[model samples]
Target: MKLNILSGLIAAALLVSGAARAATQLITEEEAKLPPPKGAVATDRRGILRGPKVEFVSPGDSVSSPMRLQLKFESFGGAKIDPESVKVIFLRTPNVDLTPRVKPFVQADGINMQDAELPPGDYTMRVDIKDSDGRPGTAIFTLKVAPK
Candidate 1:
């Protein structure tokens, strides 16, 4: 019984370490300083299937580093959200693609990032998602991170 308990404890430790290793830098300080690309337009258009609704659930307009970032996606017209179609873009000069970094936390309902590390600054992010019907939706918001 003692050996079994030890094995379980070891397995738990490995899982925690693996999760820590999977954490990616959401945005770097240098990358955030880049100027926005010329004519970089981010627009939302209505579709026949009705786009999904994206909601920012935490870390309001202002927050600190290593914060929890949660977003909820709501679909309409009997359509479901397509997790694979999610896109996260940091609205900066030559926009930074954050989709890959946040992919692990994405789901059909939304994204729940437990540890989003960012430098102190004002940042704007554009979240784009599509429904199972192929209808697109987008949400743009600004986040201000206070200096530590």
Candidate 2:
């Protein structure tokens, strides 16, 4: 009985350690080193329908890894934000689609990622969102991760 209990405790500890490692690997080193896309113009065109606005709420220009990432979303003209229409893209040569990884934390109000982990480097990201009326919106931001 004692041996069984000891093995169970060791397994549980290993699982917890694996989870922590996974949480800190949002972007891989190879992916982060890709070349920038050519003619990448981060512009948002406003049409008759107003688009949703995205604003970063924390970790100003530079921050360390394993930080909380908060973004606020606002919709205008009586239109509600469609959470399902949100897409996150890492602006690189072949834009890395981060939607799948971040879909769990996305909401109509905003995106609140509790533990966002990335390597020490400069990263650029683009967020695209649409309102219920199909009005599209885009926001581009940069995050500088300081070395540990």
Listing every candidate in turn, what is its Cα RMSD in Å to the true structure after a full C-alpha superposition? 3.4, 3.0
| Candidate 2 backbone overlaps, count | 0
Worst 10 residues of 2 by lDDT: 40-49
**What shift in Å separates residue 104 of candidate 2 from its native position after superposition?**
0.7
lDDT of 1 by residue, 6-42 (tens): 9999999999999885646799979878886576465
Best prediction by lDDT: 1
Model 2 misplacement above 4 A: 1-24, 46-49
TM-score of each: 0.82, 0.82
How does each model score on lDDT? Answer: 0.86, 0.84
lDDT, residue 131, model 1:
91
Candidate 2: Cα lDDT at 125: 89
Candidate 2 lDDT, tens digit per residue, 1-148? 9999999999999999888655635577888999888886567674544677888787787888877778899999899999999998889988899888889889989998878888899888888988998888888888789887
State the TM-score for model 1. 0.82
